[model samples]
Target chain A: MYQIQTPYLLFLGDAPDQLAAKTARGINDWRPEKVVGQMSLENCKADLGLPELGLQEAYDKGARTLVLGTANRGGVISAVWMDVLKEALHIGYDIANGLHNKVNDIVDVAGLATQLDKNIYDVRHPTEQFPIGTGEKRSGKRLLPVGTDCSCGKMYTSLALEKEMLSRGMNATFRATGQTGILVSGSGASIDAVVADFMAGAVETIAPANEDPNHWDIIEGQGSLAHPSYSGVTMALIHGGQPDAMVLCHEPTRSHMRGLPHQKVPAIKEVLSLATTLAQIVNNDAKFIGICVNTSQMVARDIEGYLKKLEDEHGLPACDPYSQGTAKIVDMVS
Target chain B: MYQIQTPYLLFLGDAPDQLAAKTARGINDWRPEKVVGQMSLENCKADLGLPELGLQEAYDKGARTLVLGTANRGGVISAVWMDVLKEALHIGYDIANGLHNKVNDIVDVAGLATQLDKNIYDVRHPTEQFPIGTGEKRSGKRLLPVGTDCSCGKMYTSLALEKEMLSRGMNATFRATGQTGILVSGSGASIDAVVADFMAGAVETIAPANEDPNHWDIIEGQGSLAHPSYSGVTMALIHGGQPDAMVLCHEPTRSHMRGLPHQKVPAIKEVLSLATTLAQIVNNDAKFIGICVNTSQMVARDIEGYLKKLEDEHGLPACDPYSQGTAKIVDMVS
Candidate 1:
């Protein structure tokens, strides 16, 4: 709901490892043109391989926003990072934070930013009030990447689809629904952070009616319809977006759900079937166009065979979007 | 999560009609023993037929709380009613409010209540943090009354089931998931008020696993799974409650979802099949024991024939719980 200025200085605040700064990695990977340079503390291990820039240097480089893109344990913004944040605000950089701890809620940092008339956008929290979803059909085409479980490449698949569509000069826009996606795309709300009643409405807000009928809104998905803990959020996204086409995203190695050890990840078939059933509640023509797998844990030699097997069984395009690209899936819609 | 001390003075503040005071009517109808007396502003047109009592008199009559149970336009707490609320707090009464405007958010009222050491419960907002739902099966049984559309008698059916089960000396508790139900039962969370990710978790928190194997938590439902605006909330409730038994609640005369004139209600068969399928995702043995219809608009002569048709078609007990009671349906689970 908050407008974040572009040309960001990505900050990895003493991240213990590269994985800890995956948020930064995602933004740099997806939107390199938006990055002025990277900034980090001495102990930080992560690197985006950009020139290290100080607050003033980054500001001078035309960086309008300072993105705290690293995540630490507990997702809290450490007190040690305050000086850098304050300096960035003073140097005319608005802050965009994706961490659980909000930059807007920290008294000193917020007060200084307020005094300087700089905006602090907390990407994890939605600041806008959304209406209750009306279930009304909107104009334009939508494609949502639903998942077999949480964190199973839905965003990656969506982004890939958007890129492929754009590369072909097809009208497409990647709609972000989570913090990393929001940071990468520079817009959209964190759907999970919205009030329960307004989850669908938030989706509707983020991906509204478009004038172009051929335009595709590549809406990123969260959680999973098969996941007990997060199915509600998934359902909201499905109903709100009312996607014309859905792609099932899965992580092959995990036997259970993301956090719940007792819960098994549903089979790809089950997810696709369920996703179609639910999606069709709003859009009767909704159909599954592909299956996107996170085959990072799979043996390289087996990836092709596995994908082929899935494709054969489900009668849909199957691929690891990061590895194979979404060209095959995009071909169907384009 | 705030505990509202019982024996309430139901305040219907200048309600223009009985419908505006339906919340007060609900509390009185479901939990009459908790009502000490009724209070209203001078122009109030609704009555519960209970003795009128002033703040001090109600307190003397064993009322520990004043329930602002009437709803006006915009659900705002009228400025004219603040005096009575303040006086009630001064007379040692905690306030239970279901209005969209919160009692705790009103600085003067909140400040006075803090000074007086009395509680102000804003039932429409959830105050406690809920963990994400784990698909792990818990002990005890839960029964949910799902609807074909929002406000189609799910709450009434659930309450009826609880009352019938209790009268039959069965172990049952009404788990409220909305403000009206919360006020009636004096407990449970407003599921829709929870953060999107925690909707299921809120339901899990409200209908927790009980030690008694025979104990049935009759969880009140919200929204319809077929509803475009609110199916997300419904999905969360279904997954979180993991209900062992369910009842299909419908208002047959309605052609579309509540507040959405463009969206038609799903068929009764469609809703039942969908409810069962979704419910069985967590609890494999989950089932629909009956159908509860709100037949208030139907002619008396057609009621029996309509119910018979539904029962014959679905092979489940069908009844208007308000008119016929839930005895036949209760027998299945009891």
Candidate 2:
């Protein structure tokens, strides 16, 4: 009876093809037990089996490490990886962010020690051995501050509340508080109808234009830089002080005369560079550096490269639309 | 001023705290994003900046509609997916299995199609349309015949070789003539030492020891099972028919163990039960089903209730360990 030991590598991403190629190379070069496995957001539904079980299955199959590709948001794919990793490694968002940014800095011993926590290394490592802070403070028994902003102008504030309902396989109401502005040029009914339709779904809060601050934020802040349309108000939200993670409503396709020309690649570079600089300034205290942009702008490669480069260069942990899928999944579950 | 759009989501896992509260859930219930963006795996990798790009990246990114998972001797992952669905979405596999499986399924899709095919689709309508198969004939590019067995007791085959190699960013001297099996393994040593340490890396392919013939197959009529006591094998190569994609070796794990004294959970019931029953069949076409198991097995939930009672049980996916740490960084370059 030979016990299958978990491989030492884990690949996380939204690109399965890239993962496959990378895994093949790793197998040819390093040869772990298994090189690649696949999972998706749609698969996280109860009917399809949630992400937690998907990860466990991989581990049981003798995967010591795992790799996840960036998953799409609409399909709800990437969130699955977060569910599994949190369960398996006792990894939290802060830890995950840490690992995602400074994985190279984690030594084999640190990896093992982090896994063992206070049980094994408490007496030995002492000062350096405490569990790395996840930047989360436990409120009672709950993992406080469970939800995050969607960058789409949605915020997930309570995982416990949401998960409580979801465990029973029930859909929960999602709330979007604060205010963001939006300007509609269409007929009053058309604009009101559109707003009403958008607010019809499980959204708990939808402030009218008068109260929405997103417009002012975008107009006065970074959003103005991202888009310089001379007119039209849009929804916005304060992203817990981290402007990058803030969500902006209103379609990006809207023309912004006198606004910055839509040079997506360079813009993405600018955002990522900003994140890197912020990460450098904030050091390890940075939780997640998020940038919300219109999907129509730059190519996927440009965004991925910018994010990867940001992580590689500044050691800052940032989350964009690509990385958010998996991160969201973990946030929901943890 | 191109507005860059990125997809993002969040999920929760069955952490001790969450599980203790019986709050394990997924993201479906949360109203996160209504229409998320999608991109091809190639584009995603280009975004991530992976060198030596290949077809697998497309699948990993969920770009391909038809992706394959793991396979067994004389079995192809794509074929298996096809066996399950009249028209599979995307076929995903490691470089080795991709080549071997692609060859085995040569009659279905063209070799060039296997290499050049892009099965990108919207996750919302995964099976909306089937990709047109490439009609190229088998050009004897495969070094190993379909179902060819090795002396060590395993099957050999091939899949998308050129795409695989290009994806990994490797240049190699490949020959069409040989009775040799390519062993895929990696050592801590640099690339220069791979050929020198080749023999030392050869090891027997091990799965669970069972008498069920239907669940297993031999390559070239050679038994695929190895000795139960074998700890590790140097390497085993499945002959990929394509010149580009060839897998050197694969390591099996304890998760494949059959009839283990453990109760089945509802999440894994469908696949695990199928695997068990199929294992009993003397020549079932289903070779492998993706099974991902992580530390969540430690959860004290009512496994029976969860598997049987839940209308839709959440399950895990298989694991790929080689994507961890700097190795992932190396993958970007490769």
lDDT tens readout by residue for model 1, A252-331: 99978888887777778777777787788889999999989999999899999999999899899998999889888988
Among the numbered candidates, top lDDT falls to 1
- Candidate 1 TM-score versus the reference: 0.98
Model 2, A7-30: lDDT tens digits are 422333343334323322322222
Best by TM-score: 1
DockQ of each candidate relative to the true complex: 0.83, 0.01
- List chain A TM-scores, every candidate, in order: 0.98, 0.24
